[model samples]
Target: MTPKQIERIQNKIKKIKRALAADKKHWGGYYHDGQGLRYLPPQFYLEINDYSGAMRYFNWFNKNFEEDSGYPIFLFEWTITLFKKKKVKEAEKKALETFCSNTYLIDVFLGKDMLEFNKNESSNWEYSSLIEHLIYSKDQEELSDFYIWLENFTTSQTFYDFANKFIEIEKAINDEPMGKKRSQLFDEKLKLLESIK
Candidate 1:
């Protein structure tokens, strides 16, 4: 796009940021009052190659919006922002969290068969499902570098080991009767998730 068009978009994003800030101030810095627009600033900042701006908005949103149900697309963007900020370990951890929340995404991105994976074991949230992946998949070209890093990470031994262990625990949790064994499995799963870093 031309410089004029880029500047226009930047101005629009700034206007949106101002509006969201006003809403937050009106709400006394409690819940985010940006309607569904809360995820846009970070994403728009990322698209404009303003990694610091994206990270700042991400940090603010995450800190203040305790009731926000996360969007997988935004989480994916957050991972990219973290990487761009040179926070490699945080980015890796966020990638795992993003994958766990939306297991079909990377698989679909890799052109793998989704049916092979246990969809029943995946997140029940619509935003973290195959449909969500499809909705945001068009943005992949804009995020090609991050996707390349993700592709390599997902193919690594570390990722495979973690995924295998997670799947095993999920399967065990599904099969086990509701009692101490199942509870123990849940604890194991939590520990495994926390061990991603």
Candidate 2:
């Protein structure tokens, strides 16, 4: 999600939880009337205590509902983080090979998250959201090839800048640039090229 989308989610949560409304920026959320005025990031929710549940709600929103599957992809990373923390490995391979796979994802995410966007100008809303989702998927080496291809397909020109940001905000989710690991994305397809005994 772009910074604004993240803030919007935070504010949506604020609506469901009133105690959180006191601050304009409750826990990084932006709040105000429908007109969009009179807001604060006061430290009140910190004292109210309902904030934690609401924050968890935000986490849930990220996990279950999003413009795309980035939330679940992020959850996959987080789940991996937990496994690494707990030192568990029994289902690790299954999780990586099957659960967190493009094949496993619903068709919407099959190859849709690779579109590129403008580097300088504001982008169309539909294009921006789609492009943002693609950017988010580009974080992992597993998803890098797709993004690179998308970038090439679109070319690095802002005349057709899809997303509002050149940051490719999707890539921001990733700590490192993804590499060209085509085989990892396909085994049988590669095997089809090999000789059989």
Candidate 3:
């Protein structure tokens, strides 16, 4: 596009940021009470190649809503932003979080057959599921390097080990009775996630 067109898009993004900020202030909640609006600024900033701006909004959203679940696409973009900033470990952690959020995403990206998995069990259609990944999947040509890195990382033996352990833990969690043993399994799961290298 022409410079004028780019400028117009930038101005529109600025307006959107202002409007979202105003709405959040008026509503008096954490990003409109956990609505998807929180992803807008970062998404827009990334589109405009404003990495710092995108990172700032991503940091704010994560800091304020650490306990809340993140959208798969949001986490994926955040991983890209972090990787661009040379934050490799943080990017890997976010990638793992994204994978855990939707196990089918990497498989889909890699063109692996997913027919063996029970689609009904993973069809949330909103968060952390194959349907959500399909809904959010878009061509990100500018992020090719990030995709390459992700492909390599996800295919690594280390990742496979972690993934297998995570699945085992999930199975144990589901099978164990609702008691201290189950709680310990949950703790083990959390530790395993945090232990991602």
Candidate 4:
């Protein structure tokens, strides 16, 4: 990619990150991706402990779809797992159809297939690296936004106190075997509710 292309993709990433921050309150679930299924976001597939964080991902997804990069479908375990097996089966079918689509992303580096990392593999933290890479090379506004959110959101002593539980919850979800992704999401929602209460 040329300097201009790099800059454009970088800028799109920023918009996505910002949008993700904006809607971090939504629980995970199966969402639409305008055209059949080729353009789907990662939220449609992963289980999330934090509703707000998942919402943020969705928010970014909507923004990205609008940007014509591609639409993202979420596999929000917390929200979608509640459906009956029949429903899940149907949704999964549609999701797979979208997943198999050819309208891949044209971003800075990896396209929409960034979610290809194996969740069960021991070294599958590669997707997180994408986040790190984008954030690591972020320009002024993104860095500032991240700092503000991190400092302002996580600096509370109460939040720090709950960090261990959060970590545990996250680990449980990330370490799950197939068909059990939503197991830890409830614990997280309960924790968030407790915090709010």
Name the candidate that leads on TM-score: 1
For model 3 the TM-score comes to 0.76
Report RMSD (Å) for each prediction in the order shown: 3.3, 17.7, 3.7, 16.1
Please, what are the lDDT tens digits per residue for candidate 1 over residues 97-154? 7776666666666666652433335355423344443433434676677667777888
Once all C-alphas are superposed, what RMSD does model 3 give against the true structure?
3.7
lDDT of 2: 0.34
Please give the clash total of every predicted structure, in order: 0, 6, 0, 19
Residue pairs in clash, model 1: none
Per-residue lDDT of 70 in model 1: 70
Instruction: For residues 65-182, write the lDDT of model 3, one tens digit per residue.
Output: 7776676767777887898888988888888877766666766665565423222232252233444434223246766677788878888887788777877777777678789998
lDDT tens string, model 4, 38-150? 22323322222233544455455445454332322222221222122224333333332222221111121122234332232233222344233231211344234333433
By summed lDDT, the worst window of 10 consecutive residues in model 3 runs over 114-123
Measured with C-alpha atoms, the lDDT of residue 48 in candidate 1 is 73
Runs in model 2 with CA error above 4 Å?
A: 1-9, 16-135, 139-197
Better of 2 and 4 by lDDT: 4
Minimum summed lDDT over a 10-residue window in model 2 is located at: 37-46
Q: Which candidate order results from sorting by lDDT in descending order?
A: 1, 3, 4, 2
Every candidate's lDDT: 0.72, 0.34, 0.69, 0.36
List TM-scores for all candidates, in order.
Answer: 0.77, 0.20, 0.76, 0.28
Candidate 2 residues 51-87, lDDT tens each? 4443444355444334333333333333233233332
Select the stronger candidate by lDDT from 1 and 4. 1
